[model samples]
Structures are given as structure tokens and as C-alpha cells.
Target chain A: MTGNTAPSQADARRTVISVDAMGGDAGPAVVVAGIAKSASKNPDIGFLLHGPAEELEPLVARRKTLKGRVEIRDARDVVTMEDKPSQVMRNGKGTSMWSALESVRSGEADGVVSCGNTGALMALSMLRLRKLPGVNRPAIAILWPSRNPQGFNVMLDVGADVRADAEDLLQYALMGTSYIRNSMDLPCPRVGLLNVGTEEHKGRAELKEAYALISQNAEKANFEFVGFVEGSDIPGDIADVIVTDGFTGNVAIKTGEGTASLLRSAIREAFEYSILSRLAALLAYTSLSRLAKRIDPRRVNGGVFLGLNGTVVKSHGGADATGVSAAVKLAFLLAEQGFAEKLAARVASAVELAQDDATSADADAPGDSETGSTN
Target chain B: MTGNTAPSQADARRTVISVDAMGGDAGPAVVVAGIAKSASKNPDIGFLLHGPAEELEPLVARRKTLKGRVEIRDARDVVTMEDKPSQVMRNGKGTSMWSALESVRSGEADGVVSCGNTGALMALSMLRLRKLPGVNRPAIAILWPSRNPQGFNVMLDVGADVRADAEDLLQYALMGTSYIRNSMDLPCPRVGLLNVGTEEHKGRAELKEAYALISQNAEKANFEFVGFVEGSDIPGDIADVIVTDGFTGNVAIKTGEGTASLLRSAIREAFEYSILSRLAALLAYTSLSRLAKRIDPRRVNGGVFLGLNGTVVKSHGGADATGVSAAVKLAFLLAEQGFAEKLAARVASAVELAQDDATSADADAPGDSETGSTN
Candidate 1:
């Protein structure tokens, strides 16, 4: 395991991230160019690029920045977006995505990064790396640009699975809190359960049950529980970690993205409507660029797979060079901090203790009302 | 009942809508001013203003346009935002919201419009107006400004209930299609079931079952079934009618609104960052305003409660005069066209047929696995 061979502080300064250099909407050229940008700026980072060597070699050779830091791994197949997850899982032995994950599994790379199909990537990761002990479900956590002091908030379970029971939601909170604490360096993150309304009586029965579980564990887990938060609070300052089932989180994120896209196109069309508006766009270019950078989804393009034995970052499918580079940077940060091992340890300890508590109560009641079972 | 009192085409030309002049965050002044604006523009519309006579009489007197078009109904109570739904339902006899709904109940007005507590309004609506026969649950339908040829798409069940079984979702699709057909004049609206992913196998068990139900009913119901759609399609052109349970719909809309607000504030701060940017803002004001008006939430302020015996439009709780006027205008249009009666009949006939199918199937197979129950 990488945990045993992680090396001394001096050797740990350098980290390797496996890259799936195929299957993204923007093509391998963008992925190669993106890694080159990250490798040039961060000398401590190296890549294990997986794809057809013929296609990737030319792209790598064209970029002076990628000179000795990139290692291309030849793979025979590519996973398309239309490929079913079950099909990919069964026939993906020689695929680039399979090779990329294999590097992480063998400890040849500290983490894996892919801009391929999200479902296929997640299915492969779960199959190869396996879920952490005591974890019923793994979640996908993303950073949303927010008005918080950290400039971003972590939202979790964004389409890993469509459902989360009370126990699954509590586990999501634990994993999310550990993630923000390790990556963002917050000592005690404030976690909020996502619901239809902020009122205590609102939302589904499972949410209300999840709220009680999360609240009970917040103090012991070293995070503050803010009870239930509405969808609007996802981008607000009330909570640093927003926890919900995959269904709500997935729909909310996509809806937010769609709205942002709508506004961007509208603003662009407005600036192109007249000559005076064109001049105004020119003058406001710098400020506009700065504003765009702050809210750009590309800047925070990575969605980390939590509760897995290994770390994996999934970039946007249509991400360009800049977006891919952002995902690479995120993988580097998580790898440097040993996020995967730390998260597993955190979840294992917390969940084990929770199970012990449930067991003791179960011994007394003998399966009366506790229903102590993993979802 | 409005179904019995609905007038002839000539009499319907002069429609009367009851306006709840209290309970909104903006106070009765905004409501009175809003009705005045609508009454001045449409000579065929009249208002039944529900509030304190002293408070509304002077506001109505100042507007010569409302001289003969408005009638004041004195109400001694006001329902505050802090009031619970159950509390309001039991003790809200003399409240403006109660008075407004009562007018519709007694066939004194063709419809009702209120910028009040959504939960209270819905509770009062269901209590006083009742649900249409054979309708399992009522849904709140809203107009989402979109890229459709009609320039808007209808989304339903925005917060009427947090839970929906497969049958409820199918009912939402049926009701939404009928709404778009009658209001937007779309002969055969394309209905899409909202899911975590567009793939058939994605999302929860209920969504999968709902997909099959909606698909089976499409041909018979006279609407195009677009299989499944993701949250991004809410603002996209693939579906003219987006149907989901109230929880997902509510969260998606609020998340969209919150994101738009974030971008709005960010753009404002960008323009105010420097004098040069302020000059650019000045030059871009005309173009910016045009874009703003196009996507303004106020332009689509009302949420109509479908599957009800009478039509009721719920405006934003904090809406100003412009927003309230928009709601009033929507109420006027629906009342003029007897939308409430038409929608009730459509739902009753369609649902009766669906229930018959369920009963015959149940009789044949007993409990084989239909789960034909409302949520």
C-alpha cells in the first residue's frame, strides 16, 4: 500500500497522478496540454498518461513543458460517454480508464484523474479501489464557489448513487467534513443537511432521520452541525459542508450550472448587441475577467470520490485545458496531503464507534427500535 | 363552485379576481398599487380587494383607474409569515388570505391571487377550494423562462408536497401537459420526467417506475413523452413540460434563483470596483437592463396550484408592485379562460381512466407488483 511506502518528508515532496488521456469531450490534446501546464509550474508533480502512445506522443512532444515529467502508457481501448457502466466494467480490461485506475491501485500513482464518463469512472473506482470499511456508500464531493471565507463550499453525494438512507447521509457528513478539514485546512467545518426547507418540520422522513444522526455525531466528529439548510444556503455562508443524497445534490448542481450558462450567454449576447456595448465590454474586460474567474466552474472542476480506498478526481466531461489543469492541481493537493488514507481512517474510526454504540443499545433492546443496520 | 358559476364568453370578458391585500412581505400598499396597475391597463378586469377598509380605501381612491373596478372587503386579521399552516387553517377566519380564497369558494370571484405565505396559502387553498375529483395530489406549476419556441417552459410540483410516488409523478405529467396545452396553446406538449441522469437506468426506483407509467400514458393522454431529462434540461429546449415531485422541483428552483442572485451581486461588485468599470457599466446599462428584464424572476412571478376546484396564483412573498401586478394579470387571464374548470375536468377524466386501468389490472393479477398508490 502507498501508506507504507509514502516515504520521508523530503521524498514526499514529489507526487505522481495518473491521467486518463482519452474519452474526454475536448480530446487528448487538451488533457496532454493541461498536464504540461501543471507540470511546468509544479516541478514536484509527474503524470502517468494513459492512452494510445501514437496520439499522445505527438501532443507531449509539442509541449516543451512536458519534457521528462510525462510518461505515456499505451492502452488499446477508449470508453465513450454512451458506454454503459455495466458494459465498461465487464469489458474495460484494456481501456485507458482501466489503466489509469490500475496505477492508483498498484501505488504507482498517488491519485487518479479522469474527465471521462462519470458513471463509468465511479463504477471502475468502486470496483478497483473498493469502499472504505464501515462505509455503506461512497459519495462524490465537489467544491462550489461561494461567499464563504474560504471562497468555496464542499457539497457531497452529487450523483454517486440516487438514494441515501439515514446512515448513508450520516456517513456523507463525516466524509465531507474530513475532506474540507484536510483539503481546505478548516479545523472544524460546519455541516448542514440539505432539505426542501430550513424549517425543522420540512423535507422527507429520511432527511429528518438523517438530521438527527448527523446532529448526534457532529460534536464527537469535531464539526458543528447547523441542522437543516435550504438549497439557497448551498452557496451561502451558513455552512461549509452541505450534505445530501446523490439525487438532490446532482439535480441542484446541474440546475445551478444551467442557470449560470444561461446568464453567461445572455451577457455575451448583450455585449454584442450594439457598437456602444462592444466598447463597454472592451473597457470592462479586466473586471469582467476577474469576476468570471471567481465564479468559473472550471477553476473548481474536480469532483473527488470520497469513502474509497484510493483518491480519484473527475473533471468536467467537456473541460478544456484550463479546466483539466485545475483538476490536476486538485489531485496534487489531495495526494500531497494523503487525503485518501486520512479520510479512510477518519471514517473507519467514526463509523466503528457509532456501530459500537448501536450494538450496545441493541444488546439492551434486542432489535426493538434501533434497527441497527447499514444501508 | 366556480365550475357552476363560470359565465358565458361575453360575461367572462369582464372577469373578477380576488386579491389578498395582506400577508405579503411588501404589505397591502404594494398589493393595492399592483391591482390598480392591472385594472388601469385591462378594462375588462375587476378586483375584490380583501383587507382593512381604512387601509385599502385611500390607496384605491388615489388611483382614478380603480374608481369603479375595485371593491373593498374588510378583514380584521392578517396572517403573518411566522404563522403555521395548521394555525392559519383553524383560526384565520377574518384574515385577508381567508377572505380572498372564500370569494373564489363562494363563486363571488373567478379566481384568487395572493403574495402570501406559500404553505399557508396552499393549506387554505386545499381546505377551502378542495382538490379536483380523482386528483390524488395538487401541484404548484410555474413558468420557467427558457429557450423554447414559446419562450417559456412549464415546471410543476414546485413545493406542494415533498413526496411523490410513481402515480403522483404521472399525475404531475398529465396536469402539466394539460396546463401547457391550455395556457401556452401547445397542442401536444413534450413532457419529461426529471431524474438524476437522462439514462433510463439511472435515478431511484420510483423514478424508474414513474418513467414507465408516464411513457404508457403519453399516447392516450395526447402528450409527447421525452423519456427522461436531467436538471440541465429544465432550462433547455428538450421538454416543454418538466415534471417532478415537489421536493426536487422546489430545491432546483431555489438553487437556480440563488445562483442568479450570486452572479447578479458579483457583476454589480465588478462594475463598482473602479471608475473606469463604472463608466463601462454606464455605457452597458441599456444592454444590461435588456438582459435583466428578459430573465427577471418577476416576469414569471406566479405559481398556479393545479388539480384544484378553483384557480389560485401564489406570488412571491416579498414581491413588490410590479411582481404583484404580474400575478394579478396571470389570475385575470386564467379566470377569463375558465382555466380552473377546464383543468379540473381534464384531470378528473384522465385520472378516472388511469384508476380504472389500475383496478382492472389489480383484479386480474391481485398484488403482483404494480404499487399503484398515490404519494
Candidate 2:
């Protein structure tokens, strides 16, 4: 494990994370620094760093903590922020991002982390890792800072695919619950369906259908169903996991981020407006820093790809060393818990239960008027 | 003008705003106080306050500014917050909310303001005053605190309808631009179509069509079209008007609000963390208050209903005196500017232009291959 000769089966305690060294806005130096930070904190972690060896070798050599724990995989190509998902899928095989995923694909690494183009990362992930059994759409789930006792709430389908049907949303719920149970150790998390209003007769036709479907499967799935939740509930204590289609979830999270960014700048501007305030800011520096740490986006930087055959964490493209380190930490935790296998098993059983429920309903009443209308 | 006897044509200087006094959660007293605040600020404003006369008479009698400027219109019933929009439309004729809208419908008032259930208010508004000619669905537009020089950016379809097609989004751009021009005094507002990404090929099918349609109509409509914008650009300086379907728009705004609220409370908690911080809070009071004033939701409480025959301002149901006053001020300003009629004319001409363009396109290329794919 210390030598990093690709952690053997005997050194199962060492969690090897394959990282795309060339994907981030910051260069491979930052990626090396991030892994070094993780290595310094956790002695059981190792890395398979991917990039052009000539460029990454110096960066890795500079980090003392990463000396014996890192193995560099040379790949000449790099995927930029401008690359499209379609283009990446067709021509990205030569890139470091592809090489990094290959390490996980071949079971050389427990998980993969990349601060690359989100679209490209998700596309390559789905193409290489494939979807789990009975899972139609794989979702990207992020932990939002919240008022909950856990300090965060899970939101899914942030931008994986813009559209999610009723069945797809139900699957997100199951996968989200499994992720939360494994990651946060919540055995029976409260799940809420994101909607315009909490009423029984609110939102789009698909949401109504999703409501009935998720509700019917809640008890069998071992989770409590909080029927409908508004956008405000994303950071609220009302639910542990909030589910929605990718488009709405993406917009909501971005809007929340933008608003928080705006307010933070405003707070700084206020403290700088007058001499009295400037003095006050100096006096309150320690308290303000604590508050900042609590809401810092860098602390919760990873977006976990759910329902995939292997675990892949997407770090923000513009992430710095701290952001990248947080993502690596998340990936390591998931990999250590064997999250991918557990999620796959959870979704497979849920699909079986759903088919059984449909069969029982058909046998009991062929013309069951209780079935949700497509409209 | 000062007496408010339902001002005649000769007394056109008086701008009468119909108020639904019974709809607010705080009751008619707060409504009276709110109108009094508006009356004290503007001399030419008047109100037709609708509620039970016995309950409203004493409240109006206590305010010197509202004495002669306010006229009470007795309506026996109130539209409760829990009532369904459908139920209110059928049995709300006797409610003060209906009477308030009737004043605008009969041209006795220039605009209407109500602190009631939003769905019921919108439903009764469409049923009473009807949609403007050539308008398909009416939208609710609200001003958001932003990085713009104007201090705010407009976002529409906040919750008026859960669905909006490509054509509906085009209308939102047209109407939103008009509202900004009349309210914010921006002659050529920059409009951006909200989507998951700024790229042309991103987002749902309707958004792509909307992007093309909005781009095509920009120059003719005298507004600068800034292609596609993400949710972050709603509060960003990149766009003055951000357009999207109601479901997405509603979720984005609420998420922003919730995030802001969470951060504000966190700020308060941070200041209360230590003795030094408590002293700093006292010293930074004025500066913090200034920042609070700039981002306070009460100052921008009203959500203006667009594309209607008459302007309707929906205040928060739980608005206090200050919140109600802000709504009243917005209604007064729009009423004085004759926003409804001007908007109707603008929309009418835009529809004609769209039709003419469609006809010309059909003639120019009988087998045009440039049409958007419905898939």
C-alpha cells in the first residue's frame, strides 16, 4: 500500500482513487497538491494520477506525501471545458479523463475523480461504466448545506439529463435513498418530491404521476415519503433527500449558488463601507470565518454520479486545491463503503418490487380507477 | 383628486388603485396602514379599499392621510388562503378580492392590488378582466435584487402557469421587455432565454425553439437578445430580463429566496457566537442595515401579473404594513404610467409581426429545412 504498486488484494485497506490530473482549470500541480493533502490526512489512501507523464511527474515529485502512494498513468490528450458530450463520447478515448475512468473500469482503482467538463464526464461515465440493472437514467446527486441535523440535504438529477419521467424520478428516489443510507448512515431517510406546491393537486402531469408512484413504493423501499416539497425545502429540515428532473434541479441549485455568492459579496461590501464597520469586521473576523467555513462551496465540492456500475465523482471545473481535495475525500469515502455495489442491489430489488405491485394490482382489479391519469 | 369620489375624466390626475383589504393574513388594519403610508408619500394617489364597511370604517378613520383619499367598498366575504383557485373562481363573486378586481375591470381604478392567494387572484383576474388580445397565457413577473446598475433584474412566469411552450416564452420576452421599459426606464433591455446552459444545443427541445424565436424577434421588438442564460444569470449583470417557463422560474426564485434567508440567519448566528462579535454587531449596525435595506424582500414584495387587460399586483399573503406598502407603491406607479394599455398595444403589434414573419418564411422556402425539431 505504501509503495503504490497498484494496491494489491492483500492491501485492501488502501483506497486507490484514479484522478484526471489534466481536467481542472488549474494545472496538474493543483491536482497533485490536493491528493497530497488527502494523503497527509488519510494514510490509507493511494492515487493513480492520469495525464502526460512529462508534465505530471515533476508535480507529483514535488509533493512529499504523494511520493510512494501515487502511480502516474501517461495519456497525451486533455479534455477542455469547451468540449461537448457528443464530441467527447466519439473522440475522448485518448484523453486523460478516459484513462482515469479506465483505471476504475479495470478495477485498478476503487473510484474515479475528475474536475473536467461535467457533460463530458457524465457522458464518458455512462458510456464506459454503463447503467445498473433496471436503471434507465443515471443521476448526479449533490449535498446542499441545510438546516437539517446532518447539516446537508441530498438533491439529485442536478444536470445529468434534462428530462426525467415518472419512473425515472422514482428511480432517483431509490438511488438517492441508497446513497444517503450508505454515505450518511441514515437507514430510512425522508424523501420528498420537488414540486411548485405541496398540495395533492399541484405541478405538472408527470409530477402527479411521480407522486403516486413514489408514494406507493415508499414503505416497501424502507423510506418515509414527504409527498411534495417546494424549492425552499432544498435547504430545509423537511426532507433528507429531495428529488426532481435534471432541468429543474440544475436551475434551482445554480440560482441558490448565485444568490449565496451575491449575499456574501454584499456582506463584505457592508463591512467595508465605513471606518466603524471596518473596525467591527476586524473584531468579528474569527466568527465570520467560522460562518464562511460552514457555507463554503469548496467543502462540499463533489457531485456523485448515481446508478452507475462504478463510482465517479465530478469536481467543479474551476475548483482549486481545496475544492479538488474535498471531492477526492468524498470519492474515497464512497469507494471505501462499496457504494456502487450497494446502490446497484438497492435499485434492482426496487424494480422487482414495482413489477410485483403492478402485477398484484392487475390481478385484483383490471380496471383500477386509482391508477394515475397520464394527463 | 384628493376626495377620491371615483375620479372623473376631468380629474384624471388622481390614480386610483383598488385594494383587497380582507385578503391579507394580517387583516384589514395592516392594509389600511399600508395605504396610509402610500398616501402620505404621494398626493395624487387614491384607493378604493374593499372589505366589510363596518370593519373598515374605524380603521380608515384613524389615518389622517387616508381620510378622504380612501373609499370603502363593502363586500361580505373573503377569499381565504386555503381555498382552491377553481373553487374561488366559481364562488368568489361575493369576496372582497372579486370586488377589488371589478374596480379595475370597470375602469374606476387604474390598477388592482391584493394580498391574497396567488392562484385565486390570478384565476379571478383572468376571469374578470380577461387576457389581452393575442396573449395566450398570462405570467407573473417579479423584480429580483441583482448586480445591474438598475439594482434589479426582471424574471417572469414565476408561477402564473406551470407550463409554457416556445411561443409562451417568446411572449414573456416581449411582455418582460415592455415592463422593464415602463418600470425601470430601460429603453432597450437585454433579454436572455433561461436554460441549463448558454450553448445553442443545450436544454429541452422547447428551449431551443424558444432561443431561435427570441433571437429572431429581438431586433424587431427593439430589445437586445443575449442568446441563452443559465439560472445564475438571473441575478447576474449579463441579462436585464431572464425568461423561462413558470415551473422553472418559480423554483429558481424560491430557491434564491430560501438561500438568502438561510445565509442571513447564519450571519446573525455568527455575530451572536462570541462576546467580541456581539460588540462588533453593535458597531456595524448602520452598515448592516444599509445592506439589509438593499436586499430586503419587503421592498420588492409585489409580483406583477402580466399580459392581462388590467394590471394586478399580488402582495405576499403574510405581508406586514411595510410589505403591503411596497406592493401599493408598485401598483400606484404602474397605474400612473398606464402600463396595461401600453402593454396590450405592444403585445398586439408583436403578434402581428410574428405572423407576418411566419407567412413570409413559408413563402420564401416552401420546403424549409431550418424548422426546429419537435423531438
Candidate 3:
């Protein structure tokens, strides 16, 4: 086992990140702010903002003091968050988001990050970029907001493959584990299966089968397989990675965001209604703000689409300047660290752990079980 | 349209509610306590317990002088929460919970309640009682604790059918609306499809069709069909009834429950171990307690399986007497208000609204698009 390898990975950084310029309500403004901040701080980094050159001129003009690390590429249309992805994929060749993804696929950009239409990005990336060998349907791995000292946990298949079979779930666990250990650099990163209960026998039939396969996998033995974790555990880092169906993961994370939002609004709305309450709220402002910041979504900006052939990071459609900045940094870090190859290797190693169970005829022949040696 | 028949739909049982004697943890004890509390002030209401002779004897002996129109029935064996649903239906011939359901089915009991296995009650109820004519799948509906004076906004299909198409979602929306409109007695319950975003085209293809169908079904307009709602809106009562796939719904509710548990632990752990922090905790006790109560899962017991042929309420697996009592009230309300029949008509009327869209062909679909549903 290659136990330690960070120096060699960090040295690889002719890395260029492609940002979707026309994405988000804030438009190129926030994306520009984020890219400007990233480029100003990191001398070695470079970025290609893909969108209309005319529109980009005004945004880039404001950042005149920016160093030579920035450039712009023009493209025609923009994919709104509300566009039908199926139709978009067929006809949106002119979209800058599409062009940005093309740059990554063609090896012009090391990675692509977008703050607009997550559904469109995932569909286009998987279609144009394709899935890695031994990877099934590419899952959208999103990092949850966290206040814990351990930081964010990557929740997989947030929307990539919604209705997952047992094998699909197992693959998610494998890929998620690799992403955490390789990209996040956690030692023997802990893996937790999200479930309604902690009991091994709990949950659906598919979940039960997946649990057995993951639990019994000898390759997974190196990592701390922490068993079942409930929803809130995702934020708490009870495990470094939480595996779930895309539907649930999406709902849970959005729910967390919504809950935090509602709480903040409730407090604000409460204070807004009365003078006495406003005075009390003023007194409580410091602690409330501290608590709000503790659960703030912006600090953790992007969620990586793991198991894809190349790196793709998706920022929340509603992300602001700070959030977009964090996403850019995340993309850079992933590129510099060469987490893809490392994660792929680690995940490939994990597949070997289930060989005993795989000896049973049907197991070895299905899905992404085709070996790298098959080549 | 029966546009103004709300008052006649009010529950018939103006006084006490009869509960399943052998339901939930601390069956008689907690039920006895709940009965005591609910009945203490009302005085006119009563609680009827149904269970095995021996179990009721101890509770009957212990309560001594407790009131609320307490009554008992003889039964045997418990339908455990962990039992396979098939076993509960086929083999639990003599179980107390089953017998209680039979009572409700027979109209001998005003309602039946059990904290035993959810899948079991749902299956058995359908097996024995079947569904309301237009209802293909039964939905489990419960109130999520809310901040508003209304207490909770109803969330349907907590875990009824693990896989459901858009038709099922429509059914949930319609049935849940009827419960809110006729039973819970809300005026024009706003229906929202639970999803990842509020954008028009933000979900799987199945949901897109469901959204279109919901929008197109403008005739009967069972309730004002609000467009997509995300997870964050659930606690905020963004709509009176929120609908989604049971799989995601179940996961979301469990996530919320698990989150509340984790937060409680976090609050305790954060404050415990030191003197000044302990003092701070004491100062914040009331506010913290209010938060705890607001998120308490147990306070609202049983999730009703709406659209079933007959009324069946699934109590939380870990429910105590309090939960059991709540389940009883839910069941009683359903029975007293003729909830199922009203729901059946509402569903039939809703089907009429979407007659051209086709409910039968698209029922219980698992994110499959051909039939038009995937959440």
C-alpha cells in the first residue's frame, strides 16, 4: 500500500481552472470576484472565463490590477437553471457552460467549476467527459456545510443516479472513500452508510445487501467503516464520507440549508415585528450571528462530481462572492493534489477486498467489475 | 364541488378517544398518562384500551383512580416493529395490533393505533380492508413540528411505498390535501412537490411531467397546486401538504429526526464538562427547551396511511405511551371525521381533474418517466 504520497502530487500545478462565467443570478460579477480573488492570491494558477467576450470585458475591466493569471474565452448561449437538460444537451452547443466543460474534456483546463444549473453541468460533464474506467454512472459528490473541527463530508450521487440498486450504492461508497482519502487526505477515512437506523438489518432490501457487501469487503478493512449514520451525522463528520441515494442526499443537504435559513429568518422576522423583541435581539446578536456563521453554507462552496474522468466541481446556484471563491480554491486544490488518479487507485484496491464474495459467479461479471487488467 | 361543507367533516367524536390497548412502548402506562393529560381538562372525553387481558390488568390496577373514560379489551401477542411486514400480515393472526385494526375496520372501535412495525400495519390494513376505489397506493402522513401556531404542516408518505411515480405523488398531494382540508380542516391546503430546487425544471424527468400534470389539472383543482417546494420549506409550512417519493420522504423525515437527536446531544455535550458553561446552559435552558420541544419527534406520533381502504396509523418504532396516545388520536380523528371515505371522494374528484393525464397507468412509479413520476 502506498501509505504516504503528498509531495509528488503537490508539485503538479500547471493546473488551469475553467469557470462558467454566465452562471448565477449575480452573473459574471460574483464569478469574476471569486476568480479575481483566487488569481490575485495564487501566482501559479491560471483561469479561463468562458462566456460572451463583450460581457466579460466590463467585468474584467474592473480587475485591471489583476496579474497575468486571468484570460477570457467567448461562447454564445447560457443554460439557465430552469432549462430542460435533455433539450439543453442536444441544442446548447453555444452555451459557455458547455464550452467550459469542453475545455476540461479537451485537456485545455484541468478542472471546471460552475455556480449555475447543477443538473445541466452534471449531465453535460458526464456525457462529454465520460465516466472513468470501472466507474458506473457518474455520481455527483457534494460536500456538506460543517462546523465540526473535522470539516466537510462528501455526500455522493446527490443527483447523478437517483434510483440506485445495491451495486450502485456499493460503488458510491468505494468512490466516496477514495475521494476522501486521496483528495481530502484523511488517513483511513471513515465511511458511514446513511440509514434510518443504526442496526445492520435496518432499512430497505437494497440497502441491506449493500451493507453486507461493504461490511464484508476485505479491501474496505483499511478504512474505518463506521456502520450506519443518521442524516445529521453528515454535518458532524461522524464519518468523513456519507453514502446515499442522490434524492435523499440532495433533500437532506437542502433541508439543512433551509433549516438554517428558516431559523435565521424566524429570528430576524421575530425581531422585526416589535421594539421590545428588537432590543432583545440586539442583545442576542453576537451569539446568534456566531451560531449562524457556525452553520453558514458559504464557507464550504463546492461539491465535486467524483468518479468522472476529469474533475468537475458544482457550486450552489445561489452562491455569493465568498462561496464562489471557496469553490475556485477547492478546484485548485483537487487539481494540484492529483486526487483523481490516487482516488481511482485506492478505489480499485478496495474492489479487491470483495474478491471472496466475488468468487460467486454473478458478482465478478456485472457492472463496473471489469478489471483494469482486462486491458 | 361541495365547496363549503367543512363543518360537517369535523370529527364525530366530541368526547373521549378509544385507543388500541396493546400499542407502543409502555403501552398502557404511557397511554394511561396521555389519556390522563388529554382527558384531564376536557373531562367529557374518554380513552378505551385494547390489548391482552393480563397486560391491561396491571395497568388497570396501577392507574387506580385515573379518568378520561378509560376502558379495556382482551387481546394477545404483539406485532413487533422489527417483524417482516409479510409475517405481520400472514402469521400475526392473533396479534393485539392486528385485532385493534380489525376493530377499526369493523367499526367496533372508533380508531386503531400501534407503534409496532409500520410496513406491517400498512400491508395488513390494505390486505384486509383494501383501498379507496381510486387510490392505488396508501400514503403515510404525519405532522412535522413547525414554528407557526398551527403546530405542523402535514408531510405524506413517510414510508408507505418505497418506490412511487408521479401519480402516487399526485395521489399523496390530493389525499394529504383532503386530510388537511376535510380532516385537519385547513382551507384550500397548498400542495407543493418536494424537490432539490424551486426552479421550474429542477428535478428528474418524472417530476417534470408530474409538475406539468399538476399544472394542467386546473379543473377540479383539489387544492391550489403550488409548484415545487424544497426540503427547507417543510418545517416552515411553505405549503400545507408536501409530496414526494416515499423513499426520499422517509429518508428526509428520518434525517430530521436524527438531526434533532444529534443537536440535542451536541447541546448537552457542549455544555456539560465545565462550570461556566454549565451556568450558561442554565441561563439558556428555556430557549433550548423550546427548541427541543419544537423539534420533538415523539410529540407527534403516528403517520396515517392516507388513501388506504381503511384507517391505519403507524406509531414510531421507539414510541412510548405518549406516542401511542397520539396515534390513537390520529386514528380516532380519521375514524370520527370519516377521513378515509372523504379522502376517497377527494381522490376520485382529483382523478377526475387529471382524467386526461391518467392516474391509473402512472401509479406507484419509481422515478420512471414513461408513466410520469420520479422524485
Could you give me the TM-score of model 3 versus the true structure?
0.80
Better of 1 and 3 by DockQ: 1
Q: Residue-wise lDDT of candidate 1 within B1-375, one digit each (tens)?
A: 112122223254578899999989879989988888887788888778888888888888888877767778888799888788899999998898999999999988888999888888999999999988877889999998677889888998999988889989988998898788767778889999999888888888999999998998776677889989988888889999999999999988888888888888887898898888888788778877887887688888899999888989999998888899999989988887777877776676666666668667542344322322211
How would the candidate models be sorted by TM-score, starting from the highest?
A: 2, 1, 3
DockQ by candidate, in order: 0.58, 0.65, 0.25
TM-score of each: 0.91, 0.94, 0.80
Please list the C-alpha lDDT of all candidates, in the order they appear. Answer: 0.85, 0.87, 0.68
Model 2 residue runs over 4 Å out of place are A1-12, A360-375, B1-12, B359-375
**Candidate ordering by DockQ (highest first):** 2, 1, 3
- The sequence of per-residue lDDT tens digits that candidate 3 reaches over residues B9-97 is 33345433445555465555666565555554443345445677666656655653443255565667777656777777778877766
Better of 2 and 3 by DockQ: 2
**Consecutive 10-residue window with the lowest summed lDDT within model 1 chain B:** B1-10
Model 1's CAPRI class? medium
* Model 3: how far residue B163 lies from native, Å: 2.5
Output the number of the DockQ-best candidate.
2
At residue A12, candidate 2 shows an lDDT of 66
* Root-mean-square deviation of Cα positions for candidate 3 versus the true structure, in angstroms: 8.3
Global lDDT for candidate 1?
Answer: 0.85
